[model samples]
Target: MLLKSPWKPRLADTEATVAERLVQALADDIAAGTLETGDRLPAHRELAWALEIGIGTVTKAYAILERRGLVRGVKGRGTFVAAYQARQGTLIDLSINAPPPILSHRALARSLMAISRKVDADYFTLYASPAGHLEHRRLLARWLETLGLVADPARLVLTGGAQQALALAFDLVCGRDGVILTERLTYPGAITLCRHTGLRMRGVAIDDEGMVPSSLAEALDSEGTSRRRAVYVTPTLHNPTTATMTLARREAIADICRLHDVPIIEDGVYGSGTEGTPIAMLAPERCLHVSSLSKTISPGLRVGVLLVTPAMECLATTALQALPFSPSPLSCCVIEDWLANGTIRSVRLELKREAARRSELAKALLADRTLVSHPDAYQAWLPMPREEADMFASSAASLGIAVTPPSAVMVAPEESDSGVRLCLGGASFDDLTRALSLLSGIGRSTRPL
Candidate 1:
């Protein structure tokens, strides 16, 4: 039988470093269970010849792995699995929203190498200024131009992640005892932020198109005495529900914000997936667009970019002043190189393909269920029979399949829905396929209460 190879190596240069080859070999050993917890790895010379690399390279690779806590080299013996296995339990974690499948690490490694060659290594070691690195800002501005939003690099703030940006936006727009508006069922992060900041949040009703314009208007009117300052929304491929607002709805909402003098905090984290004009494009002067590389690029690179209007630049700056620095420069450089080269496009294409495949899998598995989802959505919203949501979640979890029940995402404590969200983009194609199959079996079975 052929041994399984978990390391997806890239064939770029023929003279690949010994470190690179050993990394692949080590990864393969870990995947094949040859290198279990406390299993001793071969010495530098042995691993070097096994991977066709120099002894020094093997040492360097082992050092890197050790730094990552994947191995530990003993003085007398040799490198071992550190008495700690990193690949424990299910690799498929469906709780968080991650980027599309990273099929190969070759492109990422190549990008890192390119950055090391071209950019100053020391630049990545330091903290970025408030406005971020000039080159990074320039590249981000150019990319934003593609989306039809002309960004003044000075007005842009590089955040640790989109969640930080959201927190900053809340700090700037909402005051203590002030109200912030969001959809009935929205991203949990936003809700949690409001709770943390002591700011009150009003859940606006949403339909198939998104937050109802009339509902927003009504909320604003009800809060007539208090300041109705900001509105948060995910207009494209929205989280959980996967609803994209129509152009007409976008215009109406923009008009409302303009009339009420409310700043619209548009969460465009998933904006890159769809091929439509952004709400920022509709009203750049009134919209503060927040996006991150986590959705499209690697999540480990915790970098988020914000585009604020000239009017709101002072507010944006003030909020960013609290954080006072940019994210990891090494991560930014990696992402910049990927975006500069054609790697990002290729990655996106692969992601889209993988998303399509997963969608097909979901359709086939949940053929008899009622689910609200997009073809490329990371999660699916399924409305089951009353009181069945909790049971379904429990049953799925019992089978080692994690799911987000309605209670987990409910806006109000008393207003729980009779449904659950089954995430499809959490694991590899095969793992997701098996999980979905098991979930489908559960969805189809009728249990007596």
Candidate 2:
């Protein structure tokens, strides 16, 4: 009988160097157990021929694997897997709302190098305008246009990230002692911001299509006093529920806000390329669109864009100035390079593909459960009773899996609508599969709280 081939590398076509790609393929196989501890890799020439690359590239890849302690090579023999031992108490975190790790170090290095070539003393010494650099603003405006949002660059402001953007929006629309209407189940960060700023949040009812229009209208109408208030909404891949508002739904919400003359703080952090035109387009005069590259691109980039109506631009910029600092010029340079060279597009495409794949996997694993998720969302919502959600979260924690607790997303602690959100992007594919299986099994058993 013919012996099985030593190894068949499967390279992912990400934005990485050939040597880096080769190393990644080998490392992935070893991690996935496709290559055993003692499995000998094919000869360098053999792999180079099979992969249609230079022998030097293959050699460089092997050196990297050895340095990473994933493989070992013998002079007379060939390279063998030397998989590292698993840590004793490692935790698999599934609570962070982030994209899968697809942006390679090589890609970031290339961007950094490009930035270095253009760096000057002013780049470090000067404080950027409250809205960030003018060129950066212009670049972001053009970028937003690709997502179906048209805006004047003058009205665009660069923030540290979406959190800061939200802060700026909240300050501009509703200062201290104001009320902001949000989904009954909303982002935890928003809840924290409200508490920290002495602003009150009123929860609005939601359905499969996000915030209900009638509920918002009622909330607006119920404002007995003349205190300032605004509507904050996430219309695409809503946190914890994966709800994307329909175009008609968005229009209705916009009309209500317009009728009430309430400004909208549109949190589009997870809104890039998911679904629906931004509500900002419908009511350009009163929407403050808050979005960041942290969700779609590298979070470490710390770059966010805020698009404000012309009337609100001055206030927004002033609020940013009151803050201690703005997005650094160095970070802005990376953003510019990424946009100019199409690196952002490549990373986002890979991220979307990975997110879709993970969502499918989660859906299949929990087919019997009530899971609310979108094909492009990095998280899946498993709606359950409040007690049941809490119990499940505890059980998952015991099994070394961390999930977002229902309370983290609830606008009010006493509300009955509750569920735990499983973020699919933070963990490895294998770890995600294992954790979901445990969750499915836990759901079936009558475990006590």
Point out the worst 10-residue segment of candidate 2 by lDDT.
Answer: 8-17
- Give the alpha carbon lDDT tens digit for every residue of 30-69 in model 2: 6555777788888888888888999999898787667556
Candidate 2 local distance difference test against the native? 0.81
Give the clash count for each candidate: 0, 0
lDDT of 1 by residue, 264-296 (tens): 999988776345667777888878888887776
Give each model's whole-structure lDDT.
0.70, 0.81
Task: Give lDDT: candidate 1, residue 156.
Answer: 83
